[model samples]
Target: MEEAAAWLAALDAGSATREEFEAWRAVDSRRAVAFAQVADAFEQIERLRTVHDPLPEPRRLGPVRLNRRNLLRGGVVAGGIAIAGGFAMQAAAREHAETGVGERRTVVLEDGTRVSLNTDTRISWRIKGETRSLWLDQGEIALNVRALAGPPLRLSANGMRFDLEPGAFNARREPETVALLVLKGTASAENRAVRVGALAQAIGRDISVHPAEAVAIDRARSWQNGQLVFEGESLDFVVAEFNRYLDDKLVVADPRLSRIRLGGRFTNTDPTELLKALDASFGIRAKRGESGAIMLSAS
Candidate 1:
């Protein structure tokens, strides 16, 4: 599990090359199993965080590192929340909201800030005098700040705080990564600021900011339309995404099939349709086991 987490973190940090991933996966079948287990565990964290959104007391002055493995074991089942992945932020929150699996909800806070909680998302927020602050515990949220004469809206995620300049933007927090996509106005990730049509990804301790053009912006916000857009994503990555909205998880049984690249758009509501599409296009076969898990293999 540690190795799996290391590989995932390396990939998230953009430090792992394709050859490294391939070589690591080629060593043993158990490595693949470990990777799958770790992936599924994080997916569960994505959903379970909504159900168990607990805020721990503020740590001492130094930076607090949230261990993903410990978070998976302790927080998910025991309702203990850890920020995980060595990101530091203010811990206490004034209010919290969450959405269950396969659910999306729009919430209007006291300050009239409309927050759209995507599937299995949780957030902690506070509206103080002249300052609106929030923390993204897990999943994604689209914040449409009201144009009232109030404080600037601020959000904390993955150990960094963002001051959102009035407008609309989306932020997503995963186990080891945080992404900020500006849709309308401006928002600052750490010290780096982004205006309209910008995408910033914070992985580990590094941040990558890119201009979000029309196509990328549309794809990023496609979840609002009940669709998921992918371009040249791996089979494993695609399956991991499809597992988010699925009750029965999808597993790629053949390790050799993990790296096959796929592209296109698909409905996020139905996993079976995606499986069928994969079968038709990539000649992959899906089988159901008695344990209620769906396994995909080369036909």
Candidate 2:
């Protein structure tokens, strides 16, 4: 799965030459299957990147719950997969919103619920008789839900459902994890009943509620204001966060340096300046790779 995912990433970045891809594809029959799965996932993601009409909700439940296990096997999404089951509710209207690399958008629902989407985020929402519903397929969002004299609003991410209250909060969904941080009001997970001031992390088959003491509210919410403030965060995690904002991704060549801690605030919209800051502060070397990926090494 790692090999497949690496191949997909390389292809997506235009780094994999035709000969190299053909050589890898011929190595094993299973490689073809893996590649097909990764390719299919990429196709799905690409479709989301472009503008599209909202998918008519099937007579069944709301948007299908994306099964995390099926999607994050070996940290790579599998092929020929299907979305998991969803609820049996109906909404009168459906709307889709998405942002590309280095893009952020603020959307106001009909009920005055404000949602500020972070970079590379995708979400869909709708309103039924007395219910407000939202499905976050990918990326992060800061939600400021409005008080309503109606049913509780529902926010679904990767098969886990969150009942939202009239308040402010943030939610981020990744390949292997879904995190929720409440800035105000309260939210309850489908079954876990996670606490406040914590980021609920959902992994395969389990949801762990961890205190978000390490996260500064101002820093965490700074992304909405086009900034990134990290306090003593690992290099690997920091790179991942920055990758969401740029077409060229950062790859740490040295696994040993992946966990090296660093702290600072950087503009979320600028990757070049961030790289310069990284090199100056940590003596890290940043260079462009053949695949157009930025390679980071300990200098």
Candidate 3:
């Protein structure tokens, strides 16, 4: 699944070649199935966006255009039959749960495991025989894994595997790393065990486990309540975090504004309170740009 996501990202970024993708996909039949599932999920997201947001007017900058042919190099369409066959084989067993921007949801699985999904998250799972497998495609989730007479609950995110004992844990998939916070019991990755109050960050094949600070755990816990807590974080960092739940992103227009440090607890779904606080406390002004983003600058 991670390899499929990487291929999709590379294709979206115009960094993948048809030859390379085909070679990778040909290695195993399951690879085609995983790629198809990821592609289908991406298409679903695009469809949802189209339904919620109207199409913008087309802009012409120059004659150069990156069409599908230029981007995909005829790979996706050529492999459609194999992908479709693969999808049909696994469609019945796999179940998916997802949330939109600024949305949260909690679900109970068949095995009595409870999962709380954060904003803009996607996850899929399947219970086959004794193994209960879950894949976090993106975003964050908190799991209260139920103890059953089995091997263990298996979870995969960002190419890392975690065998979690029946317990609670929060997992977030970041751009470069997968953060796992063990709240109860233990989680094993790469033959190492992470206990409660411990945080594990996985980058590629390497997993680093360390004790989590009190503030860090508190910040993680706050998100489930639709709140964000910061402690002396820079303006740029705060803005970036807020943009996760915002459609019209907040931008620091002035260079000096990015360096301002502040700490507060604010609602993650809306930036109005935070904006007002910034105005009253720091003499900062917020204005909407032509692109619809909120721009911040010194008053």
Candidate 4:
């Protein structure tokens, strides 16, 4: 590990040639993992530092000057075997993705309608002249769909389909349910599509979803631009979303607190503030672990 970190510092120092680095990689698979691990380690170090800084806005932190001595020491301190490889890189390419902790992007449809990608969201759309299809693999998104001039517009997730006429609002998919929350437009499950909300599984033989004013499957929305919008959601559900944007995830010390109700518009950058806000609103307590990671427990 010490040797690998020294090699990384040499790479960063611009002293090693690409051919040299490639030659080192050719030596063995473990060497490649060790090399990549240095970058991951640096990222993790930076990410963990934010927990202590607790600043709301971004600032300039000077570059790291890793030397042989510090490289050996830090490598020993931050020891981890990197599992990410060529296959992991290829697996990521299977899906179209964009990520932000609490940010959203408006995706315009063919007929000039817009869809918003929720915080930490990823969406894939396949455009076809005859029929348009979109899919949400994970996270939540809002589809302000426009009327299709020629063919019907279709949205699918986990083998479920939704047909939209004109106006629509939020659409989401989870492991269990698919929801279409039409704020302004009309939406219905396609014929032969037996899809509904998560809890409707037992009664889903007909594939019918009852008309709802607004619906959600996994996570909630935010009132502010990048805030989280949770509605009577469990603590664990909210924490999962918060962790989605974080390199360092929140650990619950007690399982009982995870089921507590959590609702708010939380800033994605401010996990500490989010936790404090939740603690103030609900009967929750928090503690910092020895490593400075935040842990929450129900009081």
TM-score of each: 0.68, 0.67, 0.75, 0.54
The total number of steric clashes, by the backbone 3 Å criterion, in model 3 comes to 0
TM-score-best of 2 and 4: 2
Judging by TM-score, tell me the better candidate of 2 and 3. 3
Mind giving the per-residue lDDT tens digits that candidate 1 earns over 109-186? 888889987777778676766767777878888889877675468777875566787789889899999988899888
**Model 3 — which ten-residue stretch has the worst lDDT?**
54-63
Candidate 4: tens digits of C-alpha lDDT, residues 248-282: 67888888777778666667756877777767887
Supply every candidate's count of residue pairs whose N, Cα or C atoms clash at under 3 angstroms: 3, 3, 0, 3
Candidate 3, residues 96-117: lDDT per residue as tens digits? 7777777888888889899998
Stretches of model 2 off by over 4 angstroms after superposition: 1-51, 54-92, 191-196, 214-216
lDDT comparing candidate 2 with the true structure? 0.71
Clashes of 4: 3
What is the lDDT of every predicted structure here?
A: 0.71, 0.71, 0.77, 0.56
Candidate 3, lDDT over the whole model: 0.77
Off by over 4 Å in 4: 1-97, 100-103, 192-208, 211-224, 230-233, 278-284, 290-293
Residue 270 of model 1 has an lDDT of: 75
Q: Cα deviation in Å at residue 18, candidate 3?
A: 24
